[model samples]
Target: MNETIRALLSKLGGLPMPVADLADDADLYAAGLSSFASVQLMLGIEEAFDIEFPDNLLNRKSFASVAAIEKTVAIIVDGRKVA
Candidate 1:
């Protein structure tokens, strides 16, 4: 999952540095993730994970960092399993 997230970031993050070089807790916005890029990243995430983010999760906090994104995806994926 982490690798996948990193791959998505590498492809869509538009960061000045490589996503693989950033720490899990690194602030993506600070690393140059613009709002447009975040939206693109979100789309990539949805496609890659096969999960649509809930409306409640559509916010800056949910995409704050790699760890945050991982947590959000885990929640959605786990919820799907229970349903």
Candidate 2:
């Protein structure tokens, strides 16, 4: 899960921050993520995880950090893959 998050973060910025610099509870919005880019990120996450994010779940809280995203993805994926 961390690896997936790390990969996504890597593609997010050009300055190159270490993955360890991010905490699970960190606010990605404050961490330099632009609002427009965040939506693009949502698309990336959905495509990568093969899951649809709930309409009610579409909020900044869900994209707070890598850990937060992982948790959301886990719930969205619902333990089903190629069944």
Candidate 3:
């Protein structure tokens, strides 16, 4: 899941630096993730993971870093499994 999120971030993050150069807990916004790019990243993640991000997860903190995105996706995916 971390690899998938990193791959998606690499493709959609539009960051100035390589996604691989970032730490899992690095601040993506500080690494040059614009608001628009974050939206694109979110959409790509949704498609890649086949999960819709609930409205509650649509916030800066949810996409703040690779780790944050991983956690958010896990919650949604795990909830789906239980349902």
Residue-pair clashes per candidate: 0, 0, 0
State, as a TM-score between 0 and 1, how close model 1 is to the true structure: 0.95
lDDT of 2 by residue, 1-83 (tens): 66776676667532135656877777777777777767777787877777778887788877777778888788777745533
1 against 2, candidate with superior lDDT: 1
Across 1-83, the per-residue lDDT of candidate 1 in tens digits comes to 99999999998888889787889999899899999999999999999999999999999998999999999999999999999
Relative to the true structure, candidate 1 has a C-alpha RMSD (angstroms) of 0.7
Best by TM-score: 3
The local lDDT score (0 to 100) that residue 25 gets in candidate 3 is 98
The list of candidate 3 runs beyond 4 A from truth reads none
Better of 2 and 3 by lDDT: 3
Give the higher-TM-score candidate: 2 or 3. 3
Ranking by lDDT: 3, 1, 2
Candidate 1: give the clashing pairs: none
lDDT at position 21, candidate 2: 83
Q: How would you encode candidate 3's per-residue C-alpha lDDT over 1-83 as one tens digit per residue?
A: 99999998988888889999999999999999999999999999999999999999999999999999999999999999999
TM-score of each: 0.95, 0.77, 0.96
| Candidate 1: worst-modelled 10 consecutive residues by lDDT | 12-21
Worst 10 residues of 3 by lDDT: 7-16
